[model samples]
Target: MRILLVGAGLSGAVIARALAEAGHRATVIDARAHIAGNCHTERDAETGVLVHVYGPHIFHTDDEGVWAYVNRHARFRPYRNRVKSTAQGAVYSLPINLHTINQFFGRTMRPDEARRFIEAQADTSIADPRTFEEQALRFVGPDLYRAFFKGYTEKQWGCSPADLPASILKRLPVRFNYDDNYFFHRFQGMPEDGYTPVVASILDHPGIDVHLDTPFVSDMAARHDHVFWSGPLDGYFGYDLGRLGYRSLTFERFRATGDWQGCAVMNYGDPDVPFTRITEHKHFAPWETHEGSVLYREYSKACGADDTPYYPIRLVREKALLSQYVARAAGTGNVTFVGRLGTYRYLDMDVTIREALNAADAFLHAVQANARPPVFSADPA
Candidate 1:
């Protein structure tokens, strides 16, 4: 079987490797000059620090199989993502931990005390919170919401928290204890060398052929027995139903002599600060030491035609547009829309890999059973 993978990112690479191992010829193509998609990493020419070309991507997952899969390909150094925020003229721990709660209000309250204090401030009137603002006010009250989440949310999504869905705010946890780690995953780490090498290794099979800087055309689909589309969902359909909204990111790079922020990610919670967060790349790989440092000030904006899409803006408008695309994809044949862009959902690296693996398994099972492969391996809705 000849398989065509539209994008040479994690989804494409993982599925390509799986299919190739099962005696199928896999051809992976990407419009970009390099593989690994947005997670592509390269060493800074001047500073010698390995930089995340797009942005900081810390690999963390609770799935044991996914963890083992990445570990087999590349040496993963244990890296915990401890995020910080600067708001109201002071630096504080992220996720609104006990320390952050105490510092922000100038009170040294214990865990139970802090919990009760926040509870008293919380709005009990909002019975069923629908929007981001209501959810924040219900949980942490107005003052903390204004200081930490309100400004940051406005800048990140390019809309008031009042307009955004409450689910967005629910994704982030508010800790009563002093746990500042961004994620609560059982396993967390970064590739020892970089993500590109890890992906390169996955696509290194004899049955696989990779072509960089090659965009997939409608004509290309006919050449393959099956197609795994990891590119944008609307892109697969030529956006006939209208473009889905997405928030694109632009990084402003700068080099420094020593440690810049003494941490990997320092977010600016103030809306006045144009950029959302500043990431120090050197801190990502703590095992390796470098005299010089490299950092990026990440700015989020509405995605344009030419801009690289980072975060999907799945508001009311985008959801309606996405459903149309999903229908179009279903009617189309011989192609399985895979990965974040294909499904039009923001996915973690682990979730992306897990889905890729599952998609490959489903395809193989379908082939064995002499049945038609699914149009989508995962539900876009």
Candidate 2:
């Protein structure tokens, strides 16, 4: 089988590897000159620090299979993401942990006492929280929400918290304990070299041909036995219905001597601060020693046609547009949508790989059974 795997990100790389290993020819291509997509990383020419060109992507997953799969391609160094946020002229631990709660309130309360205190501060009247604002108010109360979330959410998403969905807030965990680990996963690590090499390793097989800077077009779908698209959902259809809403990021990079910010990620929760966070590249790889450091001041904005889409704003309007695209994709033969952009959802690295693996497996299974593969092995809608 000749497979056209579009977008040389994790999704494309993983699927291409699987198909190639199964003796199928896979042609992988991306409009970008790189392979890792948003997870692309490279050593800075000046500082010799491994910089996450897009942003910080700490690989943390509970799935043993996904962990093992990545390990097979590249060596992973144990890395825990400890994020800090500056709000009201003071830095505090993220995820609203016990220490954060205590410091914000200027009192050293025990875990139980802190929990009770927050409950008291919470709005008891709002039984069913619908929006992000309501959810935060119910969980962490007004004071904490204003200090930590309100300003940050407004800057990050470029919208009022009241307009955002409650599910967005659900992604964050508020711990009553002292643990400041950003993610609660069994496996948390970073590739020793960088993500680009990891993805390159995946596409190294002889059965797979990679064409960087080559953008896949709708007309090319007819030339392949099957097409696996990992590009934007609306992009695949030429945005006939309408463009889906997405948030894009712009990085203001600067070089400095020694440590900058003294941490990998330091977010500014104050709305007054234009950029949301500052990421010190050297801090991401603590094992590597460097005299100078590189930092990126990240600013989030509404995604434009030319801009790279980061997070999908799946509000009611975007969801309706996505549904139209999903329907059109279903009717289109010899093509299957995969990955975050195709699904119009914010997915972790592990989930993306897991789903890509499944999609490839399903395609192989369909071949064995002499049946036509479904438009989506894992439904994007």
Candidate 3:
């Protein structure tokens, strides 16, 4: 089968490579000029900093398979994601650990003390928390939630905490441990030459023909054995079921003389702050030192036709819209929706690669058994 992978991101590239290895012809294409999609990283000519072209992507995964898979393409350094949050005019370590709690409250409490203190502060009234606000109140209490998450989250989603689902907040770590490493992944690191080089190499096979700066959706109507679409689910069907909501980011970049924020990522949790987070590119690659720094003040906004979708705002309405898209995808023969935009869901780089690999395996199995390969990689419902 000649597999047409309609995006050169992690998902498409992985699946493309996998399909080619499995003795199938695979061609990868992307609208963007580069291969890595949002994870594209390049050297800043002026500042000599490795700038994350789309945004800062911290590759962290617990799955050894996924870690090993990525490491094969590019050598990874020992990189731990350490995030900070700024609220009420002070910066604190993120993931709401003991240090963050102690610093936020102006109390030098130990891990146990802080844990107990938070439990006491937590709202016991919210028995079965449904909304984001209630969930946060139940877990970290109102004061902490308000100071750290409420406004920031509201800004990111463009909806009040009460309107949003509790599951969104679940992604955020509420830890009692003194350890400040944001992710619990065993192997976490950035690519040696950055994401672009890794993804470019992944799609370098003779079987894979990359048509960059070329949108695949326009040519989707053309004949192909199988179309692996990694674009937005809604866009595939011409938005007939209405546009699916997505939280997009606008990167406000600036050059600085010295270290900015002293870390790779910094969250602005205050209502007064307009941006969701500020990412300093210099600190991302610790092996290389830069005299100055380049930073991106990430502002979260609603996604329009022109805007790039960073995060999927899977609200109730969006989910319903996704359902229609999913149904449309299934009925549409010789096409399978994959990746973040394809499924209209939030996915990390590791998860995307894993799913793509799984999709390829399942596809091979389907061919062997004379069954149908999955139209959608993961369940949208």
lDDT of 1 by residue, 95-163 (tens): 889999999899999999999999999998999999999999999999999988989998999999999
Candidates 1 and 3 compared: the better one by TM-score is 1
Is 1 or 2 the stronger prediction by lDDT? 1
Q: Report the alpha-carbon TM-score of model 3 versus the true structure.
A: 0.97
What's the lDDT for all of these models?
Answer: 0.94, 0.92, 0.87
What TM-score does each of the candidates earn? 0.99, 0.98, 0.97
What is the descending lDDT order? 1, 2, 3
Give per-residue lDDT, candidate 3, residue 81. 90
Model 1: which residue pairs collide? none
Runs in model 2 lying further than 4 Å from the true structure = none
**Candidates, ranked, TM-score:** 1, 2, 3
Model 2 per-residue lDDT tens digits across residues 1-381:
899999999999999999999999999989998899999999899889999999989999999999999999999999989999988999999888999999999899999999999999999888999999999999999999998899999999999999998989998999999999999999999999989999999999999999999987777888899999899888888887889999999999999998778889898999999999999988889999999999999999999989999999988898887788888887887888899988888899999999999999999999999988867657655
